[model samples]
Target: MSQRSFRRSIAIWLAALFAAYLALAYFAAPEFWTFRDRGFRTQHFEMVTHTPQGIPGDPINVGLVGTQKEVVHAFAVAGWDTADAVTLKTAIEIGESVLFDHPYPDAPVSRLLFDGRAQDLAFEKPVGAPAPRRDDGRVWETPCGGGGGRPRWGGSASFDRGVGLSHDTGAVTHHIGPDIDAERDFLMRDLATAGVLISTGDISGVGATSTGRNGGGDPYFTDGEAIVGILKQ
Candidate 1:
């Protein structure tokens, strides 16, 4: 081919490549492209460390302890919330353990909390007695009033959030106003709880649902699911 023709061909190819790149940027999800395309390198890690001061979005680097100790791991926060992120990171640092019905593993998503929140690590050991420690005045339950300094919301037997406040605190602080539309929502939430999946609301009513709840029904929105989670922090 002539020199002029060869140069022209190269220019055309470059233009086409640039156009394709721009198209991908405009149409594709940035996260899907960058994270998924790069692949999970953390699978090659030996030990992982996540700091508390950092929020979930922060990037956490883990190191490998195997034969390929030379390579470092790159992990983006796959947490649903900071709590879940912390739990997943902790799980990695402590190795692995089993709980409920699922096998918690050490993959990016497995250890990551998409909602940035994870199952509250209330007790280190799940299917047994809690860690042997003196009650350090920290109330294991919350929203339960008069016991220490918490305000007594009231006794809830069968709450949608699954909080059975046995304490006679008040007439039930679920006073979010009894709206007719809330029935189905509450019922669905309660059903989720019975199946072992605690919604954001369930986490907030943590005080009632622990050892003290499960005998009766307290009907009220109490706090919104999303709201309950945020307040716990």
Candidate 2:
């Protein structure tokens, strides 16, 4: 073959190889990693919490790494009030707060079960007038431990949009806003601002969905990523 023709052929081969590399690096490799990571998350994380009746409750979108005391202190530093347990006195107080538009900084939140047990801790922050609208989260100490043997707490953070009846049981409840991802970020920001977070990263949750329904049958959406924060010791 002529030298010029051989050079042209070599150039063509190299160009084709470069195109294949680009496809693998930009498209195929990323897709493979995504699938693999999703499977890993599914196997490792409890993606959602459940209602007492075994109905699926909120998707867990937050996590923390610390001891029980450290977790509580982090939230306290963030100005979040520890939620009162549901009791006769607290229930009556919430009822009056809803009816009379009174400010109950620490209010009782509905119970949600994770790993077949109720949350270990709950916290809330009043949004404004109209006592029902608030930011609340429930944390459960998972069996998993984080770096340095610290316990990991799985959490579901959501914004209560308004008071309403449960679509499943027709009982009174608070409807949550649809954008749960925003609520997750909101909580993370609060913790970071409180100077309690040492570092933050993400883990997989329920997976991205535009049409997710909680136990209350309220429509919600999320990016399906849970933010995991390592709290200061």
Tell me the TM-score of each prediction against the true structure.
Answer: 0.16, 0.80
In model 2, which runs have C-alpha deviations exceeding 4 angstroms?
1-45
Instruction: Please list the C-alpha lDDT of all candidates, in the order they appear.
Output: 0.23, 0.86
Residue 169 in model 1: lDDT:
22
* lDDT at 145, model 2: 93
Q: Model 1: per-residue lDDT, tens digit, 174-217?
A: 11122212432442333234432222232222221112211111
Q: Write the per-residue lDDT of candidate 2 for residues 171-197, one digit (tens) a residue.
A: 568999999999999999999999999
Alpha-carbon runs more than 4 Å astray in model 1: 31-56, 59-233
